[model samples]
Target chain A: MSSWQIIQQSLPLFEKGFVLTLWLSFIGIIGSIIVGLICSLLKYFRVPILSKIAVIYVEVSRNTPLLVQLFFLYYAFPVLGFKLNAELCGIVGLIFLGGSYMAEGFSGGFDGVSKTQVETGKAIGLSQLQLARYVVFPQGLILSVPALAANMIFLIKETSIFTVIAIPEMTNTALDLIGMYYRSNEYLLMLVIGYALILIPLSLILTILEKRVRYGSFGN
Target chain B: MAHSGINVLFEGRNLIRLFGGLWTTVEIAGVALILGLLLGIVLGVLRTFPNRLLRLVLRLYLEFFRITPTVVLLFLFYYILPRQLGVNLPANQMAMLAFALWTSAEMSDIVRGALISVPKHQRESGMAIGLNRWQLYRYVLIPQAVSLELPATVNLVTRVIKTTSVLMLISVMDVINVGQQVVEANNQKFPTGVFWVYGMIFVMYFAIDYPLSWWAKRLDKKRLERANG
Candidate 1:
């Protein structure tokens, strides 16, 4: 089929798939950031046992394949009695996976906060909580924005794995459409374009954001 | 419920079959890493060029590969490429191609970062010694770059090994696929057999990835110590 013909046929389906893709990634990114921040804060505060467990969780999740993690969450959880639908499994698995990486990002950011800054905060009679909330947290967020943005982009791409468990995301939708039309060429090409559409703009925005943050007061 | 089927996964012959699958996984990752390093070096060098056009092209290539999910890329290559090109290749070859492409993008970034991290004065010193650009890079620049690049490169190798799991999607019969096959053969066991099978796969991945991670850490520490000294 001609490229235009393929575009005409696949555009509507691609739009729907794109929306689902956005939803999965958006939820995954927000969930991961919250989980990651909590874990990072726990580690930063030296929360003894919890910190140790958080370290293990971050290391294992970051090192392993996302596909394995997804499979473990999707297939093994039910065997262990926690039954989740494919969409829920995808989102939860992605959060767990993305959270680990984001934890590292936040930890790196936290580390970049100079020791003297925290010491100065303490000297000024600020409580530990006040120091973290006002001083360390703001600087850490700015310092870690680039890495966090990169990890979020990775999470967006990773939503494609939902197709394995049939979550009707972009790849799953594309597969079904291709199966119905028998036009693998058309749908797959459109799929690539669709992915680029999501990825390129996000990446460019991240780059610009990183540049701004770098040049902003964070550098000083 | 009582079990009726033979436990093939536990049998010696079936164990060998699974081992063969494990070997294939290693082979795919091993070859892809080597090819990826070569491509990564080339692209990395191109990325550092003074020419604007070369920089632009490399940037686009890097962004496309970086953002496009590996699963989507694998699907494109395995399913769509054959249809578009009207040619067929084995699943293993297709997996290698997709991985090599993906790994190259990642490795190039590592290479670029390492190269850029070298002090500019070192380049000036080489020029002051009357060395040409090629000679400067060959002797002074690349040696330091390689040292800095080693840890990141090792980390990339571990990534390739982990990423090979995606081959299960293409039906390459790797370790994960073997686990899936075992799960299918023993559905009556509910979750016990499947749990152990996946648990073993996780252990296998850890067994491979953890050591490389340690080695990368060791390299970083050594480099830091040498610099401090």
Candidate 2:
């Protein structure tokens, strides 16, 4: 069969895999943000041992490879009596890896908030939680917009690694097509372009958002 | 009962074997860093080329690599490039080429940012002092850019080290691949050696990367101090 015919036949398979990839990325983006925000808050408040644990978590996660993390969860964890399937492992690994970077971003954003603004919030009879929710979080979010966007993009690209562990994401789907149809050139070309189509727009949107955030001047 | 798998880490030659894998990781990362830095310098210069066409082409190259996942790029170089070009480049070399391409894009940004951030008066001073273009770059521009680039470049080195682990996908016998092999070999004897083997690999990478990141932070602090003072 010709390359075009092969792609046509494989379209449904690719679409299924593409949807899985999107779902994984979506969960990764939201889950990592939540994890990152909590860690950042703990570090920001210096909550004693929890703060230190957060520091270690961020450091170890940042320092090591995401692939190692995935392998540890998918392969090694069974040995430790806590087994997650390959897909869950991939999502968990992405969240853990992305959260470390995002935690740094969040903490940096919180730090960028003026000391006087925080003090005034306390002075105005606001509880710490209220201050964080109403005053600090919004400003921190604005300051962290660029980092958050970059982290999300990084997480999306990272979903590609799922292929290695037999999680049927887009990359795995493409690999399977190539193996089945012997259309290595066409399949690889299509995969690269497919990823570029999704990724390029995300990056471009990041660039535009960064510029807007810089000009918005809320953190200042 | 839960975490006993860690015991196999210190049992025999496993630790030593992991360290050997670490060495392979370093070799891949080291070769890629040097080549990528060289390629980056060229791309950086081209990024600010006087010719608009060259700049546009370089921008596309930069964007294409930046957006594509490193693993995909690795696959392309490993499988497709040799077939297309009719050359039989080995996987290790293709791995290096892939890394060079990816890292070059990042490094170019660092170089371009450092170069552009040089004060305009400094460039004027170089021209006023009658230095030619090459001399200006060599003496005036690079000296300043080096200071700005050093910390970021150090951070990039750590990132490259972490990224080299991906080469395991292509069956490159880097640290991760080696550790996986050892784990598979010991599968029958230890049965639960996966945690020990992979854990050891993690610690080895952490040992290498943590100090580098700490040192990068120090360089960043020093750079900030120099800028402020």
lDDT string, candidate 2, B146-203, tens digits: 8999888998899899888898888887888878888887776677888788888888
What are the per-residue Cα lDDT tens digits for candidate 1 across B34-89?
Answer: 89889999898778778999888888888878867888788888876687687688
Candidate 1 segments exceeding 4 Å error: A114-135, A216-220, B1-14, B189-191, B217-229
Instruction: Please give, for residues A94-201, the per-residue lDDT of candidate 2 as tens digits.
Output: 999988989988986776676667888999999978998977888877888877887888888889988879999888988887777777887787788778778888
Taken in order, the candidates have interface RMSDs of 1.5, 1.0
List the RMSD of every prediction in angstroms.
Answer: 2.9, 3.0
TM-score of 2: 0.91
Tens digit per residue, CA lDDT, model 1, A1-220:
7868887977887899999999999999999999899899889998989999998888788778888887888887776788899889889889998998899889878777766787888999999889989989888888899879988988998888788888988888888887787877778778888888888888888889888887644433
